[model samples]
Target: MDEEQDPSGIAPLLMAIAQQDQQSFEQLYRLTSAKLFGICKRMLVQSSDAEDVLQEVYLTVWAKASQFDAQRGKPDTWLTTIARSKCIDRLRLGGVDRHTDLIDLDQLPEPEKIDPVEFASDKQRLDNCLSNLQNQHRTVIRTAFLDGCTYHDLAARTGVPLGTMKSWIRRGLMSLKACLEK
Candidate 1:
């Protein structure tokens, strides 16, 4: 927090604060608060809650900066990791699901009724069968079947025609079924 410290020196200043330097701590709070708050706001999506989490992350950073061993990663990653962990902790404690904006149950497309026991059975068999497929086909199937991509998103992402994507996924499913039965 030296008055002449360049913008990139915040991490070292943070390191200084770990040794209990109050002046550096104040300067870091003043310099990095707005950027950190913006990032937290984007992540948490609630101003007051984000502010609370921000405060908590800083307190954590102050208390835990000594835990920031540079060999593991850079300082930005260290600080951001603490911030992200704290926000997740806040969300967990607040009992708010991050996916609250997910499709309403009534509005969701009905998923295929795969028997969970059978589907979860013999994962190795499934992987081996999937490995037999070409990477492009395997990728499309994984995205559509396992990851639940829609026909449109799959088409867009894979740059395949909608019908072709559907066909690849359908054929991939049939192959998997035949392989699993064997």
Candidate 2:
């Protein structure tokens, strides 16, 4: 179902699950398992491993259901986030080798096309703003935000001090904000 047509019943089910309700948890798995499984399969690239990760995802949900904050994000997004993180962890653990040859670009479905005019304008604006950043600032900001590296991770990977890394990101974001506001 399209997002607009999908029911909002998942929130209530999550709430019940938070309270240790088995029936509600079962209902939630029945409703979202297919979607979550698809995410796992796409990331892991193996059906058996995806099935294993999906089970781990639900076990995590069962344990951390109370941590779900509806005000922070929707139920589906929260679940998807959990599944994605679990998949990444599994990938990092050497469950899957990183090889570009394993993927066939031609076999992938085409991406939805965007309006050319809007895309050009947005890309130009973003490029202009990103260009305003100093070399180190730009690298730090892009690595942290785009690559999803934590501050400590960035510091360790680049051999820069943690405080220095944070300073670069903070200053870079401020500069980016001022540029984008133009």
Which candidate gets the maximum TM-score versus the true structure?
2
As a TM-score, model 1 comes out at: 0.50
lDDT of each residue in 1-182, candidate 2, tens digit only: 22332244677777888899999999999999998898787767778888999999999999999998877766877888999888878866875632123222124332234334434565577667877787777776655442335677677766778998899889999999999998
* Runs of candidate 1 exceeding 4 Å displacement: 1-7, 95-99, 102-182
Give candidate 1's whole-model lDDT. Answer: 0.65
Q: Estimate each model's TM-score.
A: 0.50, 0.56
- After TM-score superposition, the amount by which residue 181's alpha carbon in candidate 1 deviates from its true location, in angstroms, is 37
Query: For candidate 2, what is the lDDT?
Result: 0.73
Q: lDDT of all the models against the reference?
A: 0.65, 0.73
Query: Model 1: how far is 123 from its true place, Å?
Result: 36
Candidate 2 wrong stretches, greater than 4 Å: 1-6, 97-99, 102-108, 112-182
Backbone clashes counted, model 1: 0
